[model samples]
Target: MSAPEQRFTPVLLTLPGLTPTLALEILPHGVTLHRLFVQADGRTHDLLIGPENPADHLTQKYTNTIVGRYANRLPVNQDAFPLSRNGHSSTFTPQSNESPTVSLHGGRVGFDYVEWTPLLDPSESQLFTDAEKSHLNGSDGVVGVIFKRISEDGEEGYPGRLLVETLVSLVEPSGPQAESVKTGSELKLGSVVIVYRAKLLDEGKVTPINLTQHWGFNLDASLKESLTVKEHTLSIKADHTIELNNVGLSTGSLLPVTGTHHAHAEKESKKIGEKWPTSGYDEFYVFSPRSTPTLPTRVPVSEFTPTSDLLKEIITSEASSKDPLVQLASEKSGLRVSFDSNQSGVQFYSNNLTNEKNGARKKIHGGSGVSGAGDSYGVGSAAFLEFHEPLAAWLNPSTIGHSGNDTLLASGEIYNNFVKMDVWFKSPVA
Candidate 1:
């Protein structure tokens, strides 16, 4: 007998209005965010960079996909940690997938490559409360889909059986109280909200876990234009960045962003191409604890109610009281995207390694009489913003203390990761 063929089905989430402002495509393979269409300037624009065909996602490198077991890189030699629950104790050790020296994004077969099961009736989910389920099922103009998966114990050199649930939703602007900003036009604002929840199913067991979405963005709207994100301006609400070694792993040191090209403060926006570094950015930016409201690392399953109000609180807190955690605007499209998350830090990558040689495809417009055809993308074609705990912080808390107990999930505990992206059109003057 032959191995069974994998099936890929995508779910679409949209607002309640006849002319919805936003639409999101959730691909089951890896529970990837396949595409995001935003209506602006009387036209619909695709804000995310992804493959044209759904199956093409398998060939791409974490393109708009949820990555985990562990999100980022981990040292090859991981120390065994003790896990004790109800007087039962055992040692846990993490396995590496990248090479003998490192582990990149889970293991060789991480969540990114797995096919997640879609929950047709989200009410049956164990991760949401009744209030949250009602709110997510169209109340307050919210629509979403939940994808669930089970990671068997020792699947990726990690302990415990993990139940993971990912909720991808679109929340439209509700009334005057809706979290929005005035750009050039009086466009109603909306957002793409992603919530990741996980729990250990094994009794008296523990595991190390870190989860995140790796979505590459290009505001150009069309691949035919073949524009790079260097033309975009960016701002971040961070004062320090995690120091990295030559191989790109955290050195357990936090360094100031002042007086550096990486210093794109909330008040000081800078063009990504101006004074650019050869390697582009693959660094982790640390967020100040006092800058945003404190969020719990673990929520009891019974009390895990992520209502619309909670979503608003996470994204709007920055919109109302402070600048967004990170902002990127495109001058060509008049489109801007702001991100806010409960994670302790973010990773900004400029797609430095993407190019025609890497099999990235883009539409090429012919000159004069020549016809247009498909072509490969070049380096810096897009910007990737990953919201998650500081990389490798679980190994050395003293050096990256902002994320206390974020990567460790104990028995009977639930882990929640929330991220929101608000999109709207902005006039050049504004």
Candidate 2:
């Protein structure tokens, strides 16, 4: 007679030290990132904007949850396509969620709505290889959890049984070596790493998949005095953005951000509210292609073993790179967050739709009550940075051979997506 009670497992991770500089809370439902606390300016500040109640995650607007099957939108007229791969062919038709003509964030019931099984003990799961198990064992200041789930065949109109695993971890920051350090005010840094991997279970079935985390961030440290990100400085390393139609669907064309308002924060950091666009940014900034190692053609499920190599590769690449793909900083909090990913582009949404008029009130300090616009909890209160492949590449027949392949996962192949968020604090020199 009553609805089944929803359940969630909360996992806490803290920096390894006598006094922790950062703490993170991860929930297996939707494999959500519930909370993040960063110590800066001699105070502890909550960095993420989420619902007051954890259970609200299911109904909220993707506060901080993993989106999948397809991360962004697809046209409503999604025609069935014969995916011919590995000597087999199957028709694939994506399910629509937003409208009769558009599918938003993987149809009606996406990964965000499901409860992922947590692999707290990697040794118990066959998905991880021995090396991956050891890496997940969390030694030497590393702590994380792996959440996994299976999407049955025909769910959401996608073919094949998909086994998805998401690894979320908090690691101590690696700064300059002691010998190279100058004796000035040092910056304190901490990192949150997310790795997504999936494989098709059917021997010859193929499917399309794109995954991303919808994390809305508000850097102000004080929950009682929460403020909009209007004053925050933003910088993105993108030269162009995919053109979108009036209703926000990709137009199958790329436009340079060189002379538009999109370029305002491309070259240098700028206040988010300065000369703001009327509708705010719901744009996908495109990044130049990166040279990454290709995966093997096929590895049967029985012989397949997900490794730590993908995670290591992301860390190694970030360490060697000079600049991050995206960066956001707040002068008030003296805190900065940087994002680096192997994906080709990132979608930046300025929380433009969150307002009382829209029935989307801001929740303070993850509390139950709502706040008014004057309280800085309304529109522009936060920003969502989603890193993933080009939007609707599959809709265009011409580009499907190249950019579109990023979303296709074939039988005997592995799917991996890596993203890293580094948080730091730097005080002004006196």
Candidate 3:
């Protein structure tokens, strides 16, 4: 119960060359990802959904926020989970800033709500080289920013002093991808790459850590119309899901998607409306360890099962390590967002709680378009797709059911991960 930290101004990262360029806002508060703008079809549209200001939320919910210390959840009951290393054992209590029932998003004062400092002169802390920059884009000009923070030992009742660095870069198309722009044969696509690196500052002390960008996206340019995400089409490459309990906690069961909306969607894309009967998608899709990592096959964005009135763009694959774990397309704008990550799993949460205010049902307008100091925010206004380590990996390290890897961030080891977002838009014939 200490006073809350002061919020800082937002910083913008933009790619200026592309017609419909990409822009992102990096907020000092909670090191949050605030605003995202993509130039598509002769228009620049903001794609993120949440309150305009960071202080208006009754609950942080980590909207477009950087979540960690431990990203997801760690089970802590009457008999807390036991942790042992080098003959030392400790119990993780459910104590958190979130709720007494569980430890959510690094407890009450988790990094999401706290002020994060950027390293002095990001240019001095440049982690990428000319070759690395060239790999991102052939363009002479590229833009990037690096933010860093130090988590004191036991800051959130977590062990070890942890140092985290995040780099947000807007790299334009390169090689063949860049050539298509001149030919006007292919839809231009640029990337917003997030690089995360963390290390344990205290020797011989370990911590369970997971980090993610809680991104909720909507592709529409005109917000005057009442928009619901039900019309969006989605495709996920995985075949299995990590099950969840009623309150959004993992049940430690890796189950086949089967007849559910969370099924393996590589062959075909499905509409969001089809899953209306359920609580939307709040499950983790597991990429099989047996599968080879390779570049995704390109296809028309329109191939994601577009409806006539809604289809505004075509989908094409980027040269990524694998096909996107999740592909979301809007028929209205032809704006398609493909999400890829090195993390073990992806969490999709339909902004189902936007309409709920102070625990009651109410209509509140919130998103990048409107101020969110109101009691209620936009309900189902967008969809949150999170890239991170598997849920409950800390509780059941051996049984968390990630493809093949475990979740423990050992002492003296660096945890490096990244998430990529590719936005493609198609214009109507003049």
Candidate 4:
């Protein structure tokens, strides 16, 4: 219990049920912070940069740290979320409020909280080779963490003998940082790149898998009150959208959200806003370049200054001394993101609030952070972000032992998708 007030340290949880084996390296840039490790608990999971404060989860109270077992809920009508829908398996399935269908991420013990084991070096021969294996020791410039889990047949009511393994790596930054590391091993102007790969082993054969992370982003501490993301523009070059059920669950309908009005204004009004009830966004956004308007490549779409509301593409958040403005721009900005997944949908939430849990606010120690008081952090400081999702698969072992004969579900064949995110930060305008 030797915890410091304003410093960062490695946290180990000896809680029950968990084997309590290893711990991750805590990374803090300043007041903002996070953790980094390769081999968690026993399975593999990565947030690219590990896990940020998740920006926003459960209204900033931090309830939903990572993606729940299932990204969203299953359709009320379906007995269970169908592993295969139509001809394609969508990674980001939509949300649903109906019937037995519920939300599930990695089911109970996902990757986020798992303590990973670092495999520094597997061997030079294994490099770039598709040999399908595991390594704990990572390289000096890179980090590799590995983890695995075997789900029981009826764990989450799925049907698959689930033997899943994930590998996460932090590659060396490719920018200016790589050039000036002459003195030692220090990076200058490069960003950390995260990569995740997981597969389901069936009778020692490769099967399909789905996975994602539940990462939220809040530019300003108090996402809503700061009243800025508008400055943060969104420029999405996607062509297809998966129609979600009432609660946002993917109904297996991948279409375009462009022309679909939340409602028809007596067939007269050209401007139609979000559907009647809720305001905050809770829908999956597809990344399709084919359906894009193809604006300039380097220009960013300022969400703060919305040109259109087809999607919450980018956000612009700024604060001026006299009347500061937060702006997010995207002129396509030579920046493009591609999302390929096995699930059906993606969810985005804003941190309108945070937890007063420990009486005051929680200051992030591993990364750059915002204060609750705007200039300083106290109680109730919030964070917001857009994140990936990891899928959930229930395995059965009481029957087949090691061959993966009795499976509750085929699980992650669809969610094995990736999101291409390029986030840029610049000093506040003078």
Q: Rate the local accuracy (lDDT) of all candidates.
A: 0.73, 0.71, 0.61, 0.29
Better of 1 and 3 by TM-score: 1
Score residue 123 of candidate 1 by CA lDDT: 76
Please give, for residues 1-430, the per-residue lDDT of candidate 4 as tens digits. 2323212332221111223212233211111224322222133222222123333211222232323233434333343344442232212232332334544343333333333322334333111122222212322233333333454434444344454333333332224423232333322111122223332333322222334444433333221233223223333333444465555455545565565532221223221112322343444444332222211111111221223211111111011111111112222111111222222224433333322232223232223333233332222122123333211222212111111211122322312222322223222222
Better of 2 and 4 by TM-score: 2
lDDT of 1 by residue, 1-430 (tens): 1111333566888888787878888888998887788876566677777666667677776889999988888776657666554354456665666667678888888999998878889777877656566767686677888899999998877888999999888877644644233534534458788888888898777677788999988887463464588888988777788888766778888898899988987666689888689888887788766444555667755565455234445433445223567888887878888877778778888888765444435321111211122344557877889888877666767555454654778777788888878776754545
Worst 10 residues of 1 by lDDT: 364-373
Q: Candidate 1: misplaced stretches above 4 Å?
A: 1-6, 78-90, 175-183, 186-188, 221-223, 301-322, 360-374, 401-403, 427-430
Q: After superposition, how far is residue 330 of candidate 4 from its true place, in Å?
A: 11
> How does residue 348 of candidate 4 score in lDDT?
38
Worst 10 residues of 3 by lDDT: 308-317
Ranking by lDDT: 1, 2, 3, 4
Best by lDDT: 1
Give the higher-lDDT candidate: 1 or 4.
1
lDDT score, candidate 1, position 142: 78
lDDT, model 3: 0.61
Estimated TM-score for each candidate: 0.88, 0.87, 0.80, 0.48
Worst lDDT window (10 residues) for model 4? Answer: 315-324
